[model samples]
Structure formats: structure tokens, C-alpha cells
Target chain A: DAGVTQSPTHLIKTRGQQVTLRCSPKSGHDTVSWYQQALGQGPQFIFQYYEEEERQRGNFPDRFSGHQFPNYSSELNVNALLLGDSALYLCASSLGQGVNTEAFFGQGTRLTVV
Target chain B: AQSVAQPEDQVNVAEGNPLTVKCTYSVSGNPYLFWYVQYPNRGLQFLLKYITGDNLVKGSYGFEAEFNKSQTSFHLKKPSALVSDSALYFCAVRDMWKDTGRRALTFGSGTRLQVQP
Candidate 1:
């Protein structure tokens, strides 16, 4: 089966620009979550989407938002990007709820804000 | 709020020797713990999880984790390390905040394991 897939493996944008990153969950999965991993740091939770609605969000500002479609794919949007927004954007998919399910991750989109 | 901590920034082990990466967690309810490995330029790969049952959970690549409830710690262990095992390791937990419904996994800062041949 195909694993979680993300598009635009790498991108460079200027500060204050807006960017959107896309992700397709693994087959048979329903939930999509986004994370940001800066250099020399672990991935930070951004938000999670389920049932076409945002179920949870992390400490990020309003500039970070996301959407989940009926097809179970997702898009993460960042507006008014800052220099600190440069990081690897990761998408992970899980089949079900709670702590029992395992999440499969994508290779991630490397976002570079100049 | 639920959170996890990986105290070590890096762990160095020799091939054929045992290795251990430490982790501690905090949560209001029962904590569901997990371990993952990440190679350079790759995503985090699931290794194992502790939902319930035994205190010791075994996973891929002969890796296992010991969950200590009293200590609130879950430490990843391996009997024999290989050079290929050298990578970044992360510990995470499924967290649910009162504000965020089913926020999902919260990851640790990560520990770099270098297994020398």
C-alpha cells in the first residue's frame, strides 16, 4: 500500500509570503496531522484534521491552519510567514482514534522562508 | 496537558553492546507511550508502543521498552546495537487537552544514537 505522501518536497518563499503544503494520507487512514521540524529539533505539532474539521491544534499562531477533504487528503496553510517559519513540514496519518493506533508519516515538505 | 521528555541529547554505543534511551512522561490520565526512529532526511518511523498489558513491550529490530508507572518513565532498550542503528530516536505520547480534542501524539526533543562499528 502507498504510505503517506506529501507534495513539493522543497520550497523557498520570502518572509511575509503565504504558502500551502499538501499531504495525502496512507490508504485506509482517516486522520491527518501536521508537524513542523526545525533544524536540530524534533517535530512540533501544528494541528490535526478529522472528518473535514480541525479536531486539535498546537501552540502555533493563527497563521497556521489546515483542511481535510473527503478523500482524506490534507493541506496546511501558513500566512504571513516569518523567518522562523522555515522548517520541515511533516504530515502523518492514522487509521483510528486514541493511543492504540499507530501513525504513518510522510517524507515531509521542506519549507524555507527567506 | 500531556507531554514527554527525552533527557539525553545523544547516546553513543559500540556495536554488539546494549543501548538504552531514557524517556519520562506526564499526563492527567493513563499515558499511551511510543518510540520512533528517524534517519537523515526521513520521517519518524514507529518502533513500538505501550498501551497496556505487560510492562515490557517488544517491537521491530529486536528493540524493546520498559514502562515504569511509579517512575513515570518509559525507556527504550536493545540487547545488541548495530552500526546501522545509528539514528535519531524520539519518544512520544498520545495526548488530549481540554482545549484540543484528540491532539494526537506529542513528541520528545529527540536523542541521537550513534552506534560505532
Candidate 2:
């Protein structure tokens, strides 16, 4: 089966610009989560979407938001982006909202804010 | 709040030698732990997870992790390291109590493993 897929493998945007990254979760999965991975760092949770609603969010600012569709695809939006926003955006998918479930990740979208 | 810590920034080991990447976690309740490996310019690949059962959890690519509840640590181990096994390793956790309605993982800073041939 095709795993989680993310579009726009690489992107470049100027500071203050807005960016939207897309993700299609693995088949048979329903929950999608977004994370940010800076250079030389691990992935940081941004937020999680389940049942088309944001279920949980990390410590990130309001500038970061996301949406999940009926097809289990997701979109991560960042407004008023700063240079620090330049990082690899990872999309993960799981079967349910359970701690026992393991998340499958996408290749990630590398966003470069100039 | 739950958190994970991978104390080592990098781990160097020779091929055929055993390797260990340390990880510690903090959670208000039972911790669901996980280990992921990332290659250069790639996403996190799930290696293994510890939900319950035995302390030893075996995962992909000849890797295993030992969960020590008293120590609150989950350390990834490999019996014999291979050069191709070199990559960035991350430790993640979810607090069972905090995951009542939401499930978001708390990740460690990651540890780079370099297995020299």
C-alpha cells in the first residue's frame, strides 16, 4: 500500500509570506498529524487532526493551523512566516486516536523562508 | 506535559559491534514510547514502540529497545551494527493520561548514529 504522501517536496517563500503544505495519509488511516523538524533537531509536534477537527495542538503559535478532509488528506498552513519557520514539515498518519497506535510519516516538505 | 530526551547528540560504533542509543522519558501516567530512524533528507521511519508487555521490544532492521520503568528510560539496542545502519534516531512518547482525547507525540532532540565499517 502507498504510504503517507506529502506534496511540494521543497518550497521557498519570503518572510511574512504564507505557505500551505499538503498531505495524503496512508490508505486505511484516518488521523493525521503535523510536525516541524529543524536542522539538527528532531520532529516537533505542531498539531493533530481527527474527525475533521483539530484535536490537539503543540506549543506553536497561532500562525500554524491545519485541516483534515474526509479522504484523510491534510493541509498545514503557516501565516506570517518567519525565517525560523524554515524547516522540514512532516505529516504523520495513524489509524486512531490511541497511544497504542504507531504513526506512519511522509517524506516531508522542506520549507525555506527567505 | 510529556517529554522525551535523547542525551547523546551522536553515537559512533564500529561495524559488528553492539550499539546503544539512550533515551529517557517523563509522563504523568503510563508512557507509550516509540523509536524512529531518519535517513538524510527523509522523514521519520517508525522503528518500534513500547505499549506494554515485555520490557524488550524488537523492531525493524535488527533493532530492539529495552523499556526500564523504574529508570523511565527506553534505550534502543542493536546486537551487531552495520555501516548501513547509520542514521538519525529519535525517541518519542505519549502520555496515556494526557491522550484521553488527543494523541500527539513528544519527541526527543534525536541522536545521530554513525556505524563505521
Candidate 3:
């Protein structure tokens, strides 16, 4: 089976502009979560989407938002992007809200905000 | 809050040598610990995890992690290292406490493992 898939493997945006990254979760998975990996750092949790609604969020600002569709695909939108927003955006999919299952991740979208 | 710390910034080892990458975690309650590997420009790849039961958990490739409850640590180990094993390694944790009600994982800054051939 195909693993998690993300769109626009790489993207470039300008400051004050907006950008949207997309993800299709692995088959048989229901939950999708987004993470930001800055240079020389591990990924920081952005937020998690389940049942088409946001379940939990991290320390990100309101400018970062996400949506989960009925098909289990997800989209991450960043408004008023800053140069610091440049990082690898990763999407992970898991079976449920519990920690019993290990998450599968996509190759990630490299966002370069200029 | 749950957090993970990978003490080493980078670890260098010769090919065919055994390797160990250390990780320590913090959580109010029982912790669900995980190890993920990432290649350049790629997302995190699941390596292994410790939920309960055996302290030593085996995962993809030749990776295995030992969960030490007393130390609150999970260190990834391999009997023998390979050049292809060189990559960025991350240790993540999730607080199993129901009160936290958070499913997102807290990851460490990551440790780079370089297995020289």
C-alpha cells in the first residue's frame, strides 16, 4: 500500500503572503497531524485533525490552521508567512487518537518563505 | 507536558561497529516513546516505540530501542551499523495521562548519526 503522500514537494512564498500544503493520509488511517521541522531541529507539532475537526493544537499562532476532509486528506494553511516559516512541513497519519499505533509520515513539503 | 531530549548533537561510528543513540523523556504519567529516522529533505520515518511490555522493542531495519522506566529514557541501538544508517534520528514522546488529552508527539532536537564506511 502507498504510504502517506504530500503535495508540492517544495514551495516558495513571499512574506505577508499565504500558502497551503496538502496531504493524503495512508489508507486505513483516520487521523492526520502536521509538524514543522526547522533547520537543524526536530519537528514541532503544529496541530492535529480528526473527524474533520481540530482535536489538539501546539504552540503555533492563529495564522496557522488546518482542515481534514471526509476522505481523510488534510491541508495546512499558513497566512502572513514570515521568512522564519521556511522549513519542512511534514504530515503524519495514525489509526486513532490513542498512542497505541505508530504514525506514518510523508516525505514532507519544503516551504521556503522569502 | 511531555518532552524528549536527544543529548547528542552528532554521533560518529565506523562501519560494522555497534551504535547507540541516547534519548531521555519527561512525562507526568506513563510515556509512549518512539524513535524516528529522517533522511535529507524527508519526513520522519517510524523506527520503533515502547508502549508497554518488553523494554526492548525491535523495529524496521536493524533498529531497536530499550525503554528504561526508571531513567525515563529510550535509547536506540543496533548490533552493527551500516553506512546507509547515517541519518537524522529523533526521539518522541506522548504523555499517556488521560488528563493531558493530547495526542500529538513531542519530539527532540534530533541526533545525527554518521556511520562511516
After superposition, candidate 3 runs with Cα above 4 Å error? B96-100
lDDT of 2 by residue, B1-117 (tens): 678999999999999999999999998878899999999988999999999999999999999999999999999999999999999999999755344555678899999999999
Tens-place lDDT per residue, model 3, B61-98, is: 98999989889889999999999999999999975536
- The regions of model 2 sitting more than 4 angstroms off are B96-101
> Poorest 10 consecutive residues of model 2 chain B by lDDT?
B94-103
- Residue A8 shift from truth in candidate 1, angstroms: 1.0
Error of 2 at B9 (Å): 0.4
Deviation of model 3 at B74, angstroms: 0.6
What tens-digit string does per-residue lDDT give for candidate 2 at A34-104? Answer: 99999988889899998999988888999999899989899999999999999999999999887799999
List, residue by residue over A1-114, the lDDT tens digit for candidate 1. 899999999999999999999999999999999999999888898988889989888889999999999999999999999999999999999976666998889999999999
Please tell me what DockQ candidate 3 reaches. Answer: 0.86
lDDT of 1 by residue, B1-100 (tens): 5789999999999999999999999988888999999998888899999999999999999999999999999999999999999999999998867664
Candidate 2 pairs with clashing backbones = none
